[model samples]
Target: MWFSRGLGSLNGVITIDGLVKRRGKTEILSGVGFQALPGRVTGFLGPNGAGKSSTLRILLGLDRAQQGTALVNGVPFVSLADPVRTVGAVLDGSGAHRSRTGRAHLRWVARSAGLPLSRIDEVLELVGLADAGSKRVGRYSLGMGRRLALATALLGDPPVLVLDEPLNGLDPEGIRFIRTFLRERAESGRTVLLSSHLMGELAETVDDVVVIDRGRIVAQGTLAEVTGAHRSLEEAFFALVSR
Candidate 1:
């Protein structure tokens, strides 16, 4: 697939250790830690208000942690010589300007990152946005916007992908596409770390699971291991957070 091209020998290994974050008086993360290994889709699952976002922010170096470390490929995100080629992150909705066309938005990002403009078309096609590439961002539906955001992330062709609530705005078909795409990514030796509260979708997509609740990690293991004796991952998740 075009997405797997140029991946080369790079490895995507995300390691979070003893991360602690506080917002004034409230503790956001308490000794949170986990690993997202290459060749696997690791679902960072947690309910709303859980420390998932905070942990991801710290991992991407967008936010500071009071203590501990989050490393990508054994080095801090900021320390990477070519971050764009190492990690692709989609934290929010397409960070695109409403006035610009989808293609234009990607052109701007590509130029800024010193990447080839040709890559824009490839990503747009990969995300099923080739026809909408000329449309203004304001004209896009929520799912289209999410796809655009994913396209932007793929522009870097990074070895690792970190996505937050990626399935939120997608329809069933879109969800299925993403699930298959991420699985293919992992199968092709990339690391995928996604944070989401959609239990059913996650149960189908992830190879490994990491569950966090109330600022602490409650479970981390393979899909079967984390799910344990529960009827499903959703049940196990509820049981863990309810404790």
Candidate 2:
């Protein structure tokens, strides 16, 4: 939300090595390893129960693994002196209370993150929510809620963005705006890890693809390499994970 200079050199590239996690008696992740390099948008792809959310949680330090480590810029995320300034994440919900106005929600986050109050107005405008700043999130459409979520993520202007299903509920214009925004962030040498089920979208947006199934990585490479003989990413995804 604080619109200073854009994040300059982002060292927050994600690295997960030999990550293993188990819930109850079931193994959720089996030595998963991947790298999301800076200056690129890395697409994390998998079917339901494929361990994507588990891995993301570990990376964000919201959950711990029974074995192995997940790092951001070579340091575990929890170890970052200023985690907010290092990485901004977007998930399913806007993370805003339903009764809170869009601006109220951002103000709360700003105060919690030690960001200046000025950022409330700046980020509201940045995500095209300036006109609706006073509107309660409950009354906002799905698309508007998503815009608010994104605005919150940008509040710290963090160099690394880890977004899951970011395209949810977006109109054509919203989708286009997000595409361009993410591309520009990556081009500016930031790290972006995007997890979405929209294969066609990822095919157009991501520089690299990582596919996991049944708690293990099945394939990972550039679009061309992973797709191989398939005509599209969706085809290749079905082929790789089905087995």
Candidate 3:
């Protein structure tokens, strides 16, 4: 998190408005919209096939939408002059080639972005991969691979983070590490948009919640507001999506 430290000044608000997407004849996202304000951790919650991934893909500029926009600081992701310096994203899978060493993979990214080589060591240690950075990515365990992928994302020191299923494939300890890491980043004033199906986990970490179901947002507000009359976030999530 050191690389993204003190990024408050650069932090930007994340706005998703009326986004509509389609896959062949089926509609995947139907006028979805929300916000992850700067300096707060916002959880994007939805059941499977809830259009969470589709929304994230549009926001990260990984895919285009038929209508609406996902804006970072009031601009589209692809329109940014240097996206790496402004936003760091960690989507599904470790996103690292099995053939390259962890350190080598990071170095390549740093070089491509014109970032200094020293940032590599900093992020490696930040994600607790200093010792294994030299090992081949193929040999790393799932947890280690996820850490490396996170380290790669942090290398750019982006002020905004859009993470999709970051807790996937992690053991209990690994989950705790990432949970704490994300909270600390948000506490430090970085805008964080975390997408996951884990309601209990998000209840402990997010300041705000945005619940989506079947391509549309069912609710969006602070944890308590979103939870409504439910005993916990999980129960509230079930109620919202079950309808």
TM-score of each: 0.94, 0.92, 0.94
Error in Å for residue 121 of model 3: 1.0
| Per-residue lDDT over 1-243 for candidate 1, one digit per residue giving the tens place of the 0 to 100 score | 333544334357898999999999999999999999999999999999999989999998999999999998778899977787778888878889999999999998898789999999999999999999999999999999999999999998988999999998899999999999999999998899999998988898999999999999999999999999999999999999965
Q: State the C-alpha lDDT per candidate.
A: 0.91, 0.87, 0.88
Give the Cα-based TM-score of candidate 1 against the true structure.
0.94
| Model 2 ranges off by over 4 Å | 1-10
The C-alpha RMSD of each candidate to the native structure, in angstroms, is 2.7, 3.1, 2.8
Q: How many clashes show up in model 2?
A: 1
Model 2: per-residue Cα lDDT over 22-78, one tens digit each: 999999999999999888999999987798888998998989999998988678989
Q: Which clashing pairs does model 2 show?
A: 1-155
Higher-TM-score candidate of 2 and 3: 3
- Lowest lDDT 10-residue stretch of candidate 3: 2-11
Instruction: Report the lDDT tens digits of candidate 3 across residue range 192-243.
Output: 8989998887789899999999999999999989988999999999988965
Clashing pairs in 3: none
State how far residue 87 of model 2 sits from its true place (Å).
0.3
**lDDT accuracy of residue 14 in candidate 2:** 85
